[model samples]
Target chain A: MENEFSIEVRDLTKMFGGFTAVDHISFEVRHGEIFGFLGANGAGKTTAIRMLCGLSLPTSGKAEVAGYDVFRKPEMVKRNIGYMSQKFSLYQDLTVSENIYFYGGIYGLKRKVIFQKTEELLEKLDLKHARNTLIRDIPLGWKQKLAFSVAILHDPQIVFLDEPTGGVDPITRRQFWDLIYEAAKAGVTIFVTTHYMDEAEYCNRISIMVDGRIEALGPPAELKTRFQSQDMDEVFVKLARG
Target chain B: MRTIYFILFKEFRQIFRNKAMLPIIFVMPVIQLIILAYAADFEVKNLKLFWIDKDQSQLSRQLLSKFEGSPYFRLTQADMSREAAETAMERDEVDVVLEVPAGFERDFLAEKKTQIQLTANAIDGVKGGFASAYGQAVIRDFYGDFLEENAARLSWQPPSGGTINIASANWYNPEMDYKTYMVPGVLALLVTMIGAFLSSMNIVREKELGTIEQLNVTPLKKTHFIAGKLIPFWAIAIFELAFGLVIAKILYDIPMLGNLFLLFGLSAVYLLVVLGLGLFISTVTETQQQAMFISWFILVIFIFLSGLFTAIENMPPWAQQLTYINPIRYFIEILRSLLLKGSGWAELQQQFYILLGYAVLINGLAIWRYRKRS
Candidate 1:
């Protein structure tokens, strides 16, 4: 049987010593979909993302990422996914072009291809002038855009973005979403977690995790109608509080 | 291999871009080399001496003059009473006192035995002992002279030379220049410092910045990652050794008597041992501060027992046994033999094998501990 989903989980759980960080939860995301994983802080979203990305082992569960079993085929899962955390993902001291080259090279891209992709990326982002500037010297908005581009530079089947737009202005946040849409159109699956509820509505499907369990799941319009709320923000509040 | 090249390129860029790191890696070791070589000297000189000559005889004056003539002792005051000399010693103003009794010359003429009383301040016991030994040597020479004059006056003829002749010569550093003895050991220490600290700190810095989390998710192999990290600092350590050797040659006239390739070959193996140990420490630790503290703890223990400043032979049997496991000790021994004694590979084969075994063991363990995912 051919499984068409980019990610599939069933009764997935993660425990830290005696504490269960992620309780038994399951979900499926199709290829080329922007899946918004929303939760309060410490709601086990990051832990779930780690499990899917093959960075952490699930305590007792089954997860398939990019058509590979996360437990038995983690390296395969890793090779097919890209990861970018808000706290990291780029060498601060390296120039923009060097960072691109380094990450691309690590993904085993040829030097000629890396050069071509770098030129295309800098031009598309309108960052040609800052190509030689250190990432530390660039603006935070530009860094996020570059980080997202680098995460998808290998053209992996799935790209996991953990709060990739935190602390940016509303304009840059929307611009970052534009980049995400562009990537999804290119058939790259996006597993994004965010604190911004407005960003949650932009996802094709959304899951709200509360106390290590997914409290709500569906499209934004349906979730709003079901909760009798105006938007994802109110719907999220009702799920988290009630 | 290509993955490793990418990581290596990034590490080199980061290392060179940080303005403070390059200076710390290059300049600080050289400065420490010059200063510590001069400070770690063991040769004693310029001892202070005072005298009370109650005899006031020609013999007493002559003996005192002998002490004054030697470069090791400086005569400060003369003709003081024994009590005054004691006072100066208590005040830490004098190092030694020579008291000649009143009957010194008279007893000698009457063919009776005579003695001279020598007192020394024992606060710095080693220096005091050296000063007293020098004083005794001068007196023995004077006694020989006195007997010679007497023999001439009496026309006395001996059967043969009375004493058995003893000839002592120091080999391998005939002048015993302490700098010559210390430079190679210091160079070994410099190599160890750079290799251990830089590698450990580099890994932990990545951890602290949360960059490791990004790396952990990548498809990068653990062995490739470890090799990539080790190679950059390994190259830097070799560079540092070459730089320190040039400084050692120019500043101290240290002769590089053995084969350069042999020394460098062993050094490369020794660097792997140190860098591997450092990488192992980093894997067990989480923060740069924790890594630094652990590295410092082990490095301090290794350096003190390395026979760099002191002789390993003088240590207790168990401590000497402990040095066998110390890579720094083997490197220091290899360096000293090569630079000072011109020892060849056959003489240093044992150290080479031990270091090679340690390098393999440590690096294997380090690579095992480094997991791409937990």
Candidate 2:
């Protein structure tokens, strides 16, 4: 089952000059599992995600994303994965529909397929009326959710979300999580990094990274029991304190 | 190819939507062409002159009449004292001063010897030289008429049994309108200006907007990404070239003697070079402001050295050597030859190859410099 992991990492390490952002660590993200990567500010969560998403080369390590070597087959990895950054990167000047088309087009989806997927996704998100509206005019939460939908428009094997729910109202955040859950249930592996402790509880498995190393990794409930805490937040605080 | 088309469509839509950019891209060049065309005439229209007539005889009066009758010179004042004319020259009011020496008509009648003094302002050396040469030619013509009138008295006849006569003809652009010569070159510069300035910031702008990272994560190949960004600007540049040619034809009445197909073909190739150059700038520079500044610096130098404003032949030998690498120099030469000289492919093959080579070299360099990673 471990060999069936969608993402495999061995001794993954990234260093910037004298600073080590991601220490020599190993982890595996299971196929069809929602894995939460939790870290405080500057705990190297984004850097680690960047490596896993094949955006940056690791200083020293071997990692395979979507069965492609992150070093040699980055293009293959890119083709098989979707990524949404913390910035909710979408062209503000472009309409939401235009952004969908652009992203879908670049991903090699047929025009008809893109159109169909765009209509379906907009309808599902209840954003069909605002399809022609520029992304900047929409509220930030809607843009974040739309960005995530566009990222996975091609139905990649794994979707990487970097703090996808940051600075959003709780209701919008729950809606965003519903979208993530829907993708995960459809057998798309979800690897997300967030500082929100409650969001971490929603993941099937959670890893707490501190000082460039994973301090703990297990099922969220088991980790809470092992830490003798009522919830994942107290568990994370207890582990962090230790 | 589809990705490139999508990117190009988006870029075109954005450019059209931006009201400020629309005028800058479309209207400014036409306005500059008209204004510069009128302001840049080389034909010295109004020339100021003062004359000193010490002789006050028929010959002297006749010489002064030549100056006054000529459209090139305007007689501002006349004085018997050369000193007053000299003062006028010092004050910069008079461009040229002609002094008839105090020999009256006695010298010409008795000894057939006379000398005229001419003074010119030398501040603008070229204008001063033309004025002095014009004055000398007028004096020579006046003397020739006087000599012809007294030919029998002096027994003046050609020593040869027959006289030789020569006639010269100026070909296309007979009137030598400076605007005609400049319009084609200006059109070329305008295409280059649009390409270098507009396209250079394209990728840098994406990077600034953080869209580049989004693009990088997509399945789009680097070549596809570059082509997508390049194609729209290439089309815009070609359209600008066409628009410029239309203005050249309608407003300046510049004739297109060469094949329009050939002009478009060359313009397409030249625009590729410019687009490549712009992309190369975008890849190297980190900011849009830097891209613009660098493009401006390159364009100013290229335009100055392109022989549109100045003759490359008159430049120093070392400076002329630099023109070989200057793409605008070759483009201007090609445009002028095609439009004014009606040069065929055989005549323009050398420049064609140069532009083609530059297009490949710069584009290859730009692509090589561009990396998916930082």
- DockQ values per model: 0.81, 0.59
Best by lDDT: 1
TM-scores, all candidates, are 0.97, 0.92
Q: Which 10 consecutive positions of candidate 1 chain B have the poorest summed lDDT?
A: B152-161
Query: In candidate 1, what are the lDDT values of residues B53-136, reduced to their tens digit?
Result: 888888778888888898888888776588889989899988889898998888877768888888878898777888788778
Instruction: Return the lDDT, model 1, position B288.
Output: 90
Give per-residue CA lDDT, model 1, range A1-242, as digits (tens). Answer: 28789999999999999999999999999999999999999999999999998888999989999999999999999899999997968999999999999999888899999999999999999999999999999999999999999999999999999999999899999999999999999999999999999999899999999999999999999999999999899999999996
The segments of candidate 2 whose C-alpha lies over 4 angstroms from its true place after superposition are A1-3, A17-19, A220-242, B54-58, B77-93, B104-106, B109-112, B150-168
DockQ, prediction 1:
0.81
Question: CA lDDT, every prediction?
Answer: 0.91, 0.86
How accurate locally is residue A199 in candidate 2, as Cα lDDT from 0 to 100?
A: 92
Considering just the first chain, candidate 1 attains a TM-score of 0.98
